[model samples]
Target: MSPRIPLIFNSRSWNWAVFAVLSCSLFSGCALLPRPRGLARFPKGTPATKAKLEQVKPGMTVAQVEAIFGSPGHTSKGSSHDNPPFLSWTNEDLTAAIIMFENGRVTQRMNAGGLK
Candidate 1:
């Protein structure tokens, strides 16, 4: 019977192998990571805040409001729903920066949000 040879990795080769595995694991960890709850979409333009919400007064035209808050995420009233296109801008789910209009002017501005 012939003697069998056993494979053994030297210390330097073992270190390189460990380093490669760790590097791959680090990169894969980043890719598999979950996005944060509110930061996923990462809003563009001005973020919805109490100050910005207060700035949006009733009677401001949609154009003026757009100038301030940028495009609305979603509006409660449309042209069909509201002749003047009463606007609503919700930054996140179940929350809204409410801007109301009547008589071709801003009627009410309200902030609606369930999140704390």
Candidate 2:
């Protein structure tokens, strides 16, 4: 009986094998690739929410609230003029707040509850 032997490859096959290995490596834990860059990210939650919320008072314009908390992440109707029906903001930490407005002023602010 004849014994089986491992098959050998030519130059082309070796190049393809090396290419396949390098290609896969380029994506995973690869030192050869450059680090990805992006805009600086900030947390979404209202830190010192109590203080900030206190700053917001009924009859303060949307702009006034924005000055304290920055622009809201979202709004109920997406209306620039008639907002405060409900303005909601989310933070990177997932801490959120929903401000209720009446007569174009902040009436109340509530923590947009997070996971239990």
- Please report the TM-score between candidate 1 and the true structure: 0.49
Runs of candidate 1 with Cα error greater than 4 angstroms are 1-46, 114-116
Q: Report the Cα lDDT for residue 7, model 1.
A: 56
Q: Report clash pairs, candidate 1.
A: 58-106, 59-105, 59-106
Clashes of each: 3, 4
Per residue, candidate 1 scores C-alpha lDDT tens digits across 1-116 of: 99977555656567546744653454355456676765643355445556767777766776787788765554446575435635666554435565656665777665555313
lDDT of each: 0.58, 0.55
Tens digits of per-residue lDDT for model 2, 1-116: 89977665656568546644543343243334454576323433334255576677777877787788765443333355565475656543334555667777776665543412
Q: After superposition, how far is residue 73 of candidate 2 from its true place, in Å?
A: 5.7
Task: Mark the 10 consecutive residues where model 1 has the least summed lDDT.
Answer: 40-49
